[model samples]
Target chain A: MKIPSNLAKSSLLATGIFWVIGMTDGFHINMMAFMFISYIPVFVCCTGTILLTICPFYFFGETKHFSKRQVFQRFYPYYSIVCFALCAYGIYENTNETFLIGFFVAAFFTTMQSWIWFAKESADETV
Target chain B: MKIIITIIASMLFSTLFYDQHIGLNLTVFSLVTLVALGISNPSKLRMKETLIVMGLYLLTAILVFFNHSLLSIIANCAVFFTLVGSFSEATSSVYVKWLNGIYSSIAGTFHRNFEDKSENKKPWNEDVDVLHLIKIIVIPLVVVILFVLLYKDGNPFFEEKVAAINFDFINFQWILFCLLGYYLFSNIIVPVKVQPATDSDLATENQLKPLEPLNEDNLKKEKQLGTVVLALLNTLIVLYIISDIAFLLSNTNFAASVLSNQVHNGINALIASIIFAIIIILYFFRGNLNFFDENKTLKNLSYLWIFLNAFLVLLIIVKNAQYIDAFGLTYKRIGVYVYLFMTFIGLTTTFLKVYQIKNLWFLFRKNVSVAFMLLVLCSVVDWDAFITNYNIKNADSLDVNYLIELSNNNAFILHQKKDRMVLKSNQGARIDLKYSNYVSVLEQSNWQELSYDNFKLKTDIKSYEDTK
Candidate 1:
C-alpha cells in the first residue's frame, strides 16, 4: 500500500514527538540500539522501546485511507468513549470522589470541541 | 455428541495448563497437545494415527504439568499458537467446506483476498463463532461444571464465584481513558468542516460568481463553540490525569495501614454502583452525538450537554461519596481478579474487533508479535528495584523498621547489584525479583537450595502485588 504524503508527515511528527518524550523521560535508547544488535534477550525494555517505535507507524499508516477532516471527525467519539470507560473504572476501583471528579473533568475537557457543545443553539433555532 | 466430545476434550486440555486438580491435571495435561492436535487433524490419521497423536500430546503436556519449573507463559504461548495453526489448517481443509457452513466461512477469509471489495458488499464469516461457542457455550455449560464437580471447587487460578463477586469499578477506567482519547482526537486536536471542495474550473470560468466562504459571523460563532467544547474536554483530560496521579499516590498496597482503614465493603460497593449508574446514563445519551466535523459538532454538542447534565445526578447525591473507607481492601485479590477478567475481556474484544475491522491478518500479526514480546519480557525481567520500591511504599507506611530490614536483606542487596536482580533463597526457592517469583507450599520444606523441580509441585503464589 502506498503511504499518503500527509500520513507520512503525521507519522514522522508523531515519532519525533515520541522519541523526544521517551528520551527526556530517560528511556534507554542507547541500550535499545545495542540490544537490538545483539540477539540477546531483554524482553520488557526491548518490547516497550519497540512498541513506542512501531505504534507511531501503525497510527500513521491507519490514517492514509481517510482525509484529515474525516480523520479528525472520527476521533472525538471513540476517544471520549474510552476515556469515559477508564474514568468510570477508576471511580469504581478507588472509590474516591476527588479522583472520580477529576476523571469527569478530564473527560469534559477532552470532549470540548465535540458537536455536543453547541446543542443549545441548534435546539433554540429549531424551536 | 461431537459437541460434547469436543467440550470434554477441550476441558481435558485446558486443565493441563490451568486445572487445579492433581489426578486429572497430570493425566489430562500430560498429553494435551497431542490430544488437541489429534482433535484438530483427525482426518490425517488412521484410527491408529489418531490414538498415537492424542497419546503423545497428552503425554507431553502432562510432562509439563509435572515439571513445576515449566513456566505458564511458555505453555500459554504454545496453546495460542496451536489454536491459531489448527484454526488456519481447518479453514483450508476440504472437509470444513463440505460438512456444514463452518468450512465455507473459514475458507471465505482466504477467498476474500481474491474478491473485489467494491463488488463484494456482503460481509463474510463470523470470525468468533467458534471461540464464542467454546467460551460462552461449551466451557461454561460443560467444562466448568464438570471441572467443578469432578475437580471440586474449580481451579483457584481461573475460577471466581459469580454470586460472591463485588463488581470492581477499576476495569472500566481504561475504557474511560479510551473514550476521553477519542474525544480529544476528534474535537480538540483536529476540527473539520463539511464544506464542498472548491470548484477550481468553475471559479476560473465564472468571474462573476464569487467564492463563498461560510459567513464570517458564522465562522466566529463556530470558533467560539469549538473553543468552549475544547475547554470542557481539556478539563476532563486534566481531571483524569490528576485523579490517576492521586490514586497512585495513595497506593493501597503501599499504605497497608491506611488501606485497612477503608469503610465497609457494602458502602464502597454502593457508592461505586451509584456513580456507575449515573455515568452509564450519561454515556447512553452521549452516544447520540459525535465531535468530528463542524456541521456535526453543532448537532452533537447539544447531545453532549444533555449527557453532562445527566451525569450531575451523581453529584447531587453526594451522600454516596461520603462512605469511602479510608483504607481500602489491602489484599487486592478481588481487584486483581476483576482486572484480569477485564483484561481478558479487553483481549477478547480486541480480537473480535480486529476481525470486524476486516484487517484481521495485519492487526493480528502486529499485535501478537508485540504482545508476545511484551509478555515474555514482563515475565522474565528483573524487577528488584521496582518491586522493592513498591514494597517500601506499601509496607513502610506503617513500620519503617520492616522496610529497612527488608531493604537490607539479601533480596535488597541482590537488587541493588544490578538494575535486574536474580537471587535464590537458601531454600529451593528462586527469585526473579522483577515480575515476581513465588510458590505457596502447603508444607514448609527443609531449607536447602535445590535444583529446579523434577516433579509437579502444587503451591499457591500470592498475587504479585501482595508478594511483599
Candidate 2:
C-alpha cells in the first residue's frame, strides 16, 4: 500500500491548509482579509482527523494484498454522494454557514482524489 | 425471548424511573442491560465475570450519588471500556467485526438495486411482500397523523395525553445515546475473531531478551561515560537533599513562606529529576552488566539515586500538603497528588526493573494495572464536595468566587454557607449574576440532566425558597 509520493504530498498539503484554517476559526481570528471565514475549520478538522486516523490502517503492509483499487470502487461513489448532500446542506443551512461550506469543500476534494487514484490503480491492474 | 425481555425491561426501566434519583436510574439501567446480555447468552459470560462487571457498574452509580466530579466521569469511562472489552473478548470479537456489521447493515439496505435484472420479473410476484412493507409504513404514518389532527382539534385531554409521550428532539446527545445502545447490543450479539495473544507474548519475549553486550572498545567508552554521568548526578542530588533538610525541612517558617509564594512551583523540577534518573538508569543498564564486575559501583550509585528520587517525591507531597493548608484545594492540586503518586510508583517499578531484572513489559503491565485500580478507587470519591468542605473549614483565605463556580454538587453547601461568605462589591455582583444563572439552569434542566446530585441541589434550593 505504497501511496504515490505525489498523492501523499498533496494530502499533506491539504491537511496543512485545513489545520491552519481550523486554528483561525477556533481562535476567532477576524483579520479583514479572512472575515469571510466562519466555522468551516471545525468541520475540516473533524474530517481531516478522520482521514489521518484511517490512513495508517489502509496503507499498512498486511493490507497490501487486497485490491486497493476495490476500496475506492466500492466505497467512493457513496462517499461522494454523502459529501454532495453535506455541501448542499451547508449552503442551505443558516448557522455556521461558512464552516459547513469549508467542510464540504475539503470532503469533496478528498472524495475526488480518492476516486482518481483508485480509478487509475484499477486501470493499471487491468493492463 | 431473552433479548426481547431485556429490551422491554430496559424501556420500562428508563421510562418509569426517568424522573427519579439519577443514581438509582443509572444503576437500574446498567443492571438491566447486563442482565439482558447475560440471560441472552449465558454460555459466553461466566457468572464471576458478570458479577465483577456488575459490581463496577454499581460502584460507578454509587459514586454519582456522592458527587459529579472528574473521578466519577473517569470511573464511568473505565466501566464502559471494561464492559465493552470484556464483552468483545467473551464474544470472540474484534473491532473489525463491528465495522463489518455496520457496513453490511448499510449495504444490505440498498443491495436489491444491485441484484440481477432478471429478479425484477418476479418483483410484482412479490406484491404480497410489498403490501406487507406498505402496511408496516402506512400504519405508523396514519396513527401519528391521526393523533396530530386530533390534538389540533383542541381537546385538552387529548393534548395532555399526546404531550405525555415525550419525543426527544434529534440532537447530538440523543444520537450518541442511540449509538451507544446500538454498539452495546451489536457487540454482545455478534461473535467475531478473537485477537490472538501471540502479539503480547512476542512483545514480552523481545523485551526479556537482553541486547548483545557492547564491543570491548565501546564498553570501555560507555563505562567511562556512565561513571561520569552517574557520579555527577549522585553528588548533586545528595547535596540538594542535604540542603533541603537544612533549609526547607529544618525551618517550618521558611518552608511555609516558600509555599505561600506558590504551591507547586518546585514540584515540577522534582518530577523532571525523577524522569531523568529513570532514563539514566535504563541507559547504563541496557544489557547485562555482569561482563564488567567494575560496573557494580555504577549500579550501586544508580540504586542510591533511585532512593533519592523516592525521597524527592515525598518532599514534593509534603510541600503540596503545606500549600493546600495555606491556600486551598483545587482539581489541579489534587491532580498533582495523583501525579506524584504515579511518579513514585514508576520510580519503584524502575528499581524493580533494574534490581530484579524484570522486563519492560512487566514494568509497564504492573504500573498500568496499578494506575487503573487507583483511578477506579479515585472515582468513588466526590472531589468537588471534598474540596469545597475542606477549603471552607481549613483555609485562612476563602475564595467564595471559586467555590460558587464549582459544579452543582457543591451548590447546596455553598448555599448553606452563604451567610458566612465575605464578599467585595464586585464579587457580590458576580455572585448575584451566577446565582441567577444557576437558578435558570435548574429551571431549564430536562430529564436528561437529572441526576442524584442535581436533584438534591434542586430540592435544597426549593426548601430555601419555601422558607423565604
Candidate 3:
C-alpha cells in the first residue's frame, strides 16, 4: 500500500500554509518573542498543527502506509538555502522579527517547490 | 429507512427554521445534517468533515447574527452550498461544489431523485421514494385543497366539508413545506456528486503534453493562429490605450453623466474583452500545442496579451478613480474596483498557465481559490460603513437617498455625520430609519443572535441617549 507522493507533498504544503499564515496573524512580532520564552505551549501548538495536517493526508492519501521520510525527501536542500538567505537578509537589514516571517514563507515555498516537484512526478497516480 | 430519516430531518428543518432568526437554529440545522449523514452514510461521517461542516454553519450563523446584511445572507447561502457539496466530494472546486449543491437542492425540492440507474433505484411499493409518496399523498391533498378553496368561494357552507385542516402547525401549507423540506433533506443527507464536474476538478494534471503528438500539423496551425491573433490584438489594444490616455490628459472637465457613462461602459466592455482574451488563450493552449517545439512565439504573444490586458484593467481603474474623485463612492463603483482586482488576478493566473503550459483547470483552481479567499475576507468587512463614511466626506453631490438605502451597518456613521452634512433634515430622517430597521433586525433575537456589532450599536444608542 504505497501512497502516491502528491498527497504527502500536499499535506506538507498545507502545514507550511498554516505556519506562514497562522503564525503571522493576530499575534504580533513582540508576542511571538514571548512564545519563545513560554516554549511548552508553542511546542503543543506545533504538535497539534502537524497532527491536524497529517490526519487529513492519512485519511485521503492513496495508501494506509505512512512514511515520514518520503514526504521530507529533498526538503532539506531547499530549506537550508531559504534559511541561509533569510538569515543573511535579516543581518543586513537589522530586522529580526519580520525576517523570521521571511524565513517561514521562504521555507514555505522552498518546501512547496520541493513538494511540487514530487506532485508533478506523481500526478498520474493521483489524478 | 433513509426515507424515514429524511422525513424526520424535514420535520426538524421546518420546525426550527420556519419562523426563527438564523441563530442557534443554524446550529440545529447543522446537527440535522450530521444526523442525516450519520444515519445514511455512516462510514463517511469522519470528524474532519463534520467539524468543517459545523464550522461553516457556525460562521454563517455568526455573520448573519451580527449584521444580517445582504452580503452576510449571500455568504450564508454560499457556505451552506459548500457544506452540502462537501458531503459528496471533498476535493472539487468551490464552483463545482456549488453546482452540485444547487443541483441536489433543486432535485430534492422537486422530488427528482436522480439516483443511479442501475442499483440505487427501488420500487415504489418496496420503499416509499419521494415521488411515490408525492403521488400517493401530496397530489391528492393538493387537489383537494385547491378544490376546497374554490368550493369555499362558491358555497359559503362548504368550508366545513373540507375536513377543517386548520391547525396551526398541521395546515395544508405547512404540510407542503415540510414535504418539500423532506425531499430536500433526503437529497442532502445522501449527497450526489455530478460525476463529470467532480471528475474535472479531480484532474490535477496541468500540462497539455499528452493530448497529442507535439509534431502534429494541427499544433503548427494553432500556433500560427494564436500568434496572428495575439499580434493583431496587441496592436489594437496599444492604440486603444494611447487614445484613452490622450483623452484623460486632455479632458480636464466633463459632464457627470458623460464620465459616468464612459467609466461604466468602459468597465462593461473591459469585462467582455478580458473574458474573450482568456477564452482565446484557453482555446489555443488547450492541448499538445503547448508542447510544440516552436510554440515560443505564440506563448510570448499570449504573455504580452495578458500583460496588456492587465494594463487595460489598470487604465480602467484610473478612470474609475477619476469618476469617484469627481462624484462619490457608491456600491456600484466599489464593486467595479473589486471586479477589476479579481480580473487582474484572472489575467495573472492565465499568464502563469500559458507560461508553464498548464491546463485550463489550473487557471480555474487558482482563480477560484483566490476568489473564495477574497469572498471570505469580504465577509469580515462592513462595507456599508466604508461606503457611507467615504461618500459622506468626499462626495461632491451626496445622494442622501442612496445613503439612506444602505443597511444599519452605516447607521452610527450617518448619525455622527448628521450635523456636518448640508442636508441635515434628510440625514436626520435616514438616521431615524436606521434606528427603526436596527430594532426590527433584532426584534426576535436571543443572546445567541446578538453579534458584537449589535452590542456596539446598542452602546452607541445608549451613549447618544446619555448625551441628549
Candidate 4:
C-alpha cells in the first residue's frame, strides 16, 4: 500500500517503458506520443503476464509452509540460471524468432527473481 | 543505488560486446555479475564451501570453453545455483527457496502494485502527480525531437543515418539481449535472502523416532528372535559367499554372458536382500542389542551379516567391471558402478551405526553427505569424453551411433578417427550421415558458438576434408 516501495513502482514503470520501446521498433515522431500514452496497456499486459505465470504457485498455497526467504534462497537461483543458460544457448544457435522472444522473457524473470528477493532481504535487515 | 547503476552500466557494456566472441562475452558477463554481487553482498564464504564452489566454477568454465554443450551449460548453472544456495541464509531445501523467490518476484510484485494503487485512493492527486511527471519528460523530449529533425534535414550524412533507422522491422534479438543484460545487472545487485529452518518448523514436520522401550519380557523375546534371525541369515550369507567364490572367483575363463547375467540379475536382488536383512536386523535389535551383557552373540552375528553384505558388494563390483570390459561402457553401467559404491558406503555406515549405538539421523546425515561429495566428484570428470574415448579404444564393441550422439566433445575425436573406423554397411552409412550433419551444424554456427573445442573441431575437420 501507499506505492509499496520506490523499487516496486520503478520496476513497473521500467517494464512498461521496455514493452513500449520493444514493441514500437525504436522511436519515431508520429507514434512517439501515442506510444507514451500506451504505457497503460503495456503495464497491464506485462503485469497480467507475470501474475498469470506466478500466481498459481501462491493460490495453491505452496508458499504457506516456507516463508519467502526460505523458498527463494534455496532453489530459485538454480532454476533461473538453468533457464537463462538454455535461453542463451537458443540465442547462440540462432534457432528461431520464438527463442529470441523467449530469451527476453527468461531474462526478465531471472532478473526479477533476484531483485525481489534481494530487495526484501535488505529491507528486512534494515528494519 | 550506485552499485545498481554500475551493474546496469556493466550490463549495457556486456550487451554491446555480446556478439564479439562466445568465450569473451560470457567471461565479461560472468565477471561483471560476480563483481556486482560481491559489492552488494559482502558476506565472506566459509573456507571449505568457498573452495568447493570455486572448484565447481573452474570446472564449469573449462567445460564451457571446451564447448557449451547441454551438459556444460547445465553443470555451469548447477555451480552458480549451488554456490548461491549454500551461502544463503535459508535452511530449507534450495529448490523450495528458489521457487518462493520466483513466485514473490512475479506475483508479489503485482499484488503490491495493486495494493499500492488501492491505498492511494486520492485519484485527483495521483493524476496530478502523473501529469507533472509527464510534463517534465514531454518538454525535453519535444525539444530533442525538433533538434534531431532539424539536424537530419540540414546534414545529408545525418539524414542518411536517421532514414536508415527502420521502425517497420523490429529486431527482437537485440531486445532480448538488452533484457538479458538488465536482468544480469539486477540479479547481481540484489542477492536473494533465505531463511534458516527454525525449531518450530522441524517440530511441525514429522520426524522418525527410534524404537520405543520394551518391557523386560518383550526385551527377552526380542533378544531370542534376534539371535535366531542373525544366526540363520549369517549361515545363509556365508553359504552364498562360498558359492560365489566357487562359481565366480574359481573360474579362470569367465564368459561375457555369464558375467552380464550375474551383474544385471544377481546384483540387484543381492543388494535388495542385503537392504532387507539390514532392516530386519535393525527392527529386532533396535532397543534390545545395545546392552552388551545380554545379547553379545546376536550383536556379533549382526556385525558378521553386515561384513558379508560388504563382501557381496565387492563381488558385484568385480562382475560389473568384467561386464564393462566385455561389452564396452554405457551410462547404465557407469550408474551401476556408482550405485554399487553407494551401497558399499551405505552398508559400512549402517554397520557403524549399529556398532556405535548411534541414532538413525546420524547415519542419514553421514550417508547424504557422502552421496553429495560423490556427486561433486563425479561432476568433475568429463564423462562424455571418457565414455567416448573408452568406447573408441574398444572400437570392436563400439556403438558408433551412440558415440556420435554423445556430445560435441566427442565429435572431434570421432571426426579424426573416422577414416580408420571399419564400419559395417548400416553403421557406415549412419556414421557418414552423422558426420555430414556435424559439418552442417559447424557451418551454421555463428560467433555465439565460438569455443576452444568448437574451434579445434572446425580446424580438424577442415584439415581432414582437405586431405580427402
Q: What TM-score do all the candidates reach, one by one? A: 0.24, 0.62, 0.62, 0.64
Candidate DockQ values, in order, are 0.01, 0.05, 0.01, 0.15
User: Model 1, stretches more than 4 Å misplaced?
Assistant: A1-127, B1-20, B23-86, B89-228, B239-468
RMSD vs true structure, all candidates? 28.2, 12.0, 23.5, 8.4
Off by over 4 Å in 4: A1-127, B1-34, B45-47, B67-69, B90-165, B168-173, B188-190, B196-236, B239-246, B249-259, B274-302, B356-364, B426-448, B458-468
Comparison by lDDT, 3 against 4, better one? 3
- Candidate rank order under lDDT: 3, 4, 2, 1
Isolated chain A: TM-score per model?
0.32, 0.45, 0.27, 0.49
Cα distance off (Å), candidate 3, residue B88: 0.7
lDDT of 4 by residue, B1-468 (tens): 644565475555545454453443454444554555455556634445544654666667666655555555565655555545434433433343333344332233322322233344343355467767878997888788778877887899988888788755655546555654564445434434322332333333222344556366767778888889788888988898788878876775667677777888767777676788769766865554565357677778888888888888888888887777766788888988888888888888777877777656556656766765566567566677788778778734667777776765666677667667666667666666666676677666566455665566657768888878
Q: Candidate 1 lDDT, tens digit per residue, B392-447?
A: 34432322223223321123223233223222332112223321222232123222
lDDT score of residue B117 within candidate 1: 29
Model 2 docking tier (incorrect/acceptable/medium/high): incorrect
Could you give the candidate ranking by TM-score, starting with the highest?
4, 3, 2, 1
What is the per-residue lDDT of model 2 for residues A19-67, given as tens digits with 9 covering 90 to 100? 4434433332123124324234433554454456334434541244555
What residue pairs clash in candidate 4, if any at all?
A71-B97, A71-B98, A72-B97, A74-B94, A75-B94, A75-B98, A76-B98, B90-B194
DockQ of 3: 0.01
Q: Report the C-alpha displacement of residue A106, candidate 1, in angstroms.
A: 55
State each model's CA lDDT, in order: 0.33, 0.58, 0.65, 0.59
Pairs of colliding residues, candidate 2:
A39-A99, A40-A99
